[model samples]
Target: MKIAFVGKGGSGKTTLAALFARHMVETGRPVLAIDADINQHLAAALGAPAEEATLPPLGEHLPAIKEYLRGDNPRIASAAEMVKTTPPGRGSRLLRVVEENPVYAACVRPVGGVRLAATGAFTEADLGVACYHSKVGAVELLLNHLVDGPGEYVVVDMTAGADSFASGLFTRFDRTVLVCEPTLRSVGVYRQYASYARDYGVALSVVGNKVEDAADVDFLREHVGADLLTWVSRSAYVRRAERGTVGPLAELEPANRAVLARLAEAVDTTAQDWDRFTRYAHEFHRRNAAAWANERAGTDLTRQIDPDFVLGPSALSAPVAG
Candidate 1:
């Protein structure tokens, strides 16, 4: 299962993502956490030291990643021609939830009990030359090609706000945990996200964060309604962890911990929709291709989509055309 935590900036999405990843790992499930947020703080949140937190950003090696994923598929002539929206075909390399491929070997690092991968930080050089979308494109491409299965989990801490809608990245997850605080601005972000998500058939659950009293919960309910899956109360343990004094998962406040379990259960029980997943990959690739990627590549990028292909666990063992 792929779960993404997104919300307004400072709404505690990163903290929730870290906690959920830790919770799943502790419960004996295979979990991988990818920090696709521009801030690149997930490593520290997951208890990695300052030095270890500097992960090999996936953006730095987009060309190499494209090369590996293209994998002798006749439709894609070269990595340079592959855009972030490129969908995997019969001959393309498909990734497992946990694997030893070069992409993971170089980019994935262990932080406590959770496996971590970062989209890299927005650096000084990128200030004027590039958009953060280019960096985040690495994650979009990764999701475009990978195939996950039952008992496996991928937790992504996404960029805040409706910026995710700028690419097809928002549709990549099995479930999205929108960490909303009981504030007008927070609920405003939820409204924007929900409007866009509803069109794509996104399975979203609103997790209210930092609730103080019954009033806060009521506020969330009044705004988000039935989409409100659960809420986390204020916690001294979380505050301590935020301040750098990290503690074990077992040390979390019982109420907050239960919230994490509930969040995990909500994601764990959602059925995988590989058909919808593959359809979006093709849909977005066609859109990107027609809009810009095709002109950039000097060929119709739609050719890259294998009409007979469906990405899933079974696709992993299916025969390749090449």
Candidate 2:
């Protein structure tokens, strides 16, 4: 199953993303958790250390390419080189290289023995591009890498806010679960986001994050409608983590675990549908699994959705413009 969390900032989005990753791992799925946000805080919230990489943000290349394409003085390299360096393809170039102390090796830390790979920090270019424009575009490319990578599940803790989530990357995943607090602002954000998701290709859902009361959950439900799927109660652990407390959440805070389990169920449920990226993934899995079913049936084929049929009911809703 592949999913992403998107909503406005200060709505506990990073925390929601971390918990979702942890929950997937705990449930025995090999998960690829990505910090697609350029702010690069998801890893830290997930208790993974942030490392500094020298590569540029993928977004930076676009504008640089734009500038260079327009004959402006630009540092962007050739498209072939860009494709060669990062390669754009998920498993190509730097992403697929094997190494001792591989960044993602630790990024995918074990929690009760579940494997997870995540980006602990942004590359130099990633940071610059994030600061410039197209932070969402950079994230989309990064997710393309992870979707190309091997994993049963992919969970994205999107950077703080709705715009980034609404960008193309959100549509790339099978499910987009908006995490929001219960304040009036959050409710408004949830409504706006749910409406947007309906228009985009994302299967929009709402999780009442930091739920503290029945009324709060109901309040979210009133606005989110069918988009509202789960509710996560408030937890001291969330508070502790907010202060920089660290490590895998093997202890499984009750509030945290409850919502995570719901998210897990949501992820599992969404895996069965047709979506934009699902078809390509399905084809990849079909061939790979076909090869393995003969000799490697035990191989994992979870992220394998077919993007060939990214049409019909599964397509994300489009935005209703003025």
Candidate 3:
């Protein structure tokens, strides 16, 4: 499904995207993980062969999300009308109107082997997308490309916070995984973003990276939602990043590995309800509770994030039409 890893800066969204991407690729899905963050860490975490990447501006002067895709999607200006005319054959009939030509197709980078590109940012309806047409529909296309596309899975490592970029894409995703550690500061961000998810109609799943206790999961649940997807605990080998090695994805870390596996299953499952999807996924929530209590929080976070980067606070704060 179209998945967005959202949370505060340095909250582990990128690394988790890498871990999840790696998990799916290994499991037999040809994955296409999008580094839409513009800060662009998903490629680094994947250790993509390209040393240099020409990424588009986080949300620049791009076309509507549907405009980039190849498929049957309607572009109705009225929400009520679009809802009445969604694509022809969906069980839920969520959309009544199809985006005659909806969603953008995956874009490839000059350097990275993977084909990925993000919207140049929706201008003040510069593309003329009205109520029925949503950036979220772009998300639906992304999610469809992941689970229902040629690619086995797609991971969208979002820009910091739960502003428009993340919020816009959240609705199309199967899960809004809260990637963070055990700091109140991070948890506080998760809380705010979760509230955004609640407001935007995006599902949420908590995955703690570099964590050190069950209390961490408890705290996230208390603040965010009940389903804690998985905790990718910290590891000393993370420092290997200095030498360009990935340690957080170590298969040896059964705790994190198991969590990843469960997350894959949860995301893969066919539960359409936001609450039901996370609800079933929560069964594995803190499955290995003590692992958190026993381990020392690790430090190497492979993903690099620059706040001033295009997808950072600037893009997040930039206003777009609702």
* TM-score of each model, paired residue for residue: 0.98, 0.63, 0.58
Q: How do the residues 208-238 of candidate 2 rate in per-residue lDDT, one tens digit apiece?
A: 8778788887877777777777887777777
The order by descending lDDT is 1, 2, 3
Q: lDDT of each structure?
A: 0.91, 0.53, 0.49
TM-score of model 1 (CA atoms)? 0.98
Q: Model 1 off-target regions past 4 Å?
A: 320-322
List the RMSD of every prediction in angstroms: 1.2, 13.0, 15.9
Off by over 4 Å in 3: 55-106, 109-115, 118-151, 165-167, 199-201, 214-218, 221-225, 247-252, 273-322
Tens digit of per-residue lDDT, candidate 3, span 72-165: 2222222222211122111111211112222222243422234354433445655555332233344333332222332345577777775543
lDDT of 3 at 110: 25
Better of 2 and 3 by TM-score: 2
Q: Which is superior by lDDT, 1 or 2?
A: 1
Of the two candidates 2 and 3, the one with more favorable lDDT, higher being better, is: 2
Candidate 3 TM-score, C-alpha based: 0.58
Instruction: Please give the TM-score that candidate 2 achieves against the real structure.
Output: 0.63
Error of 1 at 140 (Å): 0.7
